[model samples]
Target: MTDRSAAGTTFDDFVAARSTALWRSAFLLTGDRHKAEDLLQVALVKTWRRWDRLTGGVEPAEAYVRRALVTTYTDWWRRRWRGEVPTGELPERPTTGRDGPGAVDVRRDVLTALAGLSRGQRAVLVLRYFDDLTEQQTADVLGVSRGTVKSQASRALAALRSSPALTDHDHPATEEEPS
Candidate 1:
């Protein structure tokens, strides 16, 4: 048999092998399918750019892609034209022409709670918990010190715990506002 791929792998084959896992990571990072697709596209572009540099194997390629995804997500939030997608578990609205006030309230609360976080804090939490990055990896991904990552993560969790969205489980209901 003759060898065809110089690196012994085709780009299309690589995409086929990794797209599912990559899509899952992207979803966790962006909290929305649309944003996830955008992130994945950016990651793929970066992967293509460095394909030769990633000749070590899939492990290196995967790491490169992950790093790209995380960095792209961080930059996206920092953009003036970008907005946070809703990060809650519910349908947007009811089909029966109902106000679905409770659903709307819940969604708003969740969105507000997440918004309470600094961009760095949110990225830290998502990278650490959602993406399951080690503290060191998260720090590297965010281009910050590990100490900064830990502090931001602590503050982010504390804010989530204190958010009125959480209080809804026991306290009186109230209208939510953006953070």
Candidate 2:
């Protein structure tokens, strides 16, 4: 087998290939665009520092970066500022465009519902459902047990089910199964 360290696979190449997916996961975790950018940057920096050890294809690098992202995000939650920072300009509402206001509202409502969850619960939901990671994968990313992942997912789902914002809407966060 050719040594990947001798082969191309630069950190830049890895970032170029997976930045969008990483950024989307960051956005899901942070629930804000700018924070997501910061999170992704931090994770990439961590990955770059360990790049020599992460020398496979993009998969290892991506996995390492994702773990960094979740760990950093969990750390941020501990000391996160409760007070809102004032900005000079109000952030513009996302244009509904052809999808219309309902689509935007649904997105907003779901985000709001997610925001209501505890950090662990939110992380589990994002990593499992949104990122489509398996139970073991999510547990590995968060450094928790598979049982913890399942329980957190159950609690997060139950919370979302009972969320007033989602409950009021015609479309629920999760589709109800037939009785």
Give stretches of model 1 more than 4 Å off.
1-9, 80-112, 167-179
Model 2 CA deviation exceeding 4 Å by range: 1-7, 82-92, 96-101, 168-179
What is the Cα-based lDDT of residue 86 in candidate 1?
A: 41
lDDT of 2 by residue, 34-108 (tens): 999999999888877777787667777777888999889988877673443323233447765775866656666
What are the models' TM-scores?
0.67, 0.81
Clash pairs of candidate 1?
A: none
User: Could you tell me the TM-score of candidate 1?
Assistant: 0.67
**Cα miss at 69, model 2 (Å)?**
0.8
Number of the top-ranking candidate, with lDDT as the measure: 2
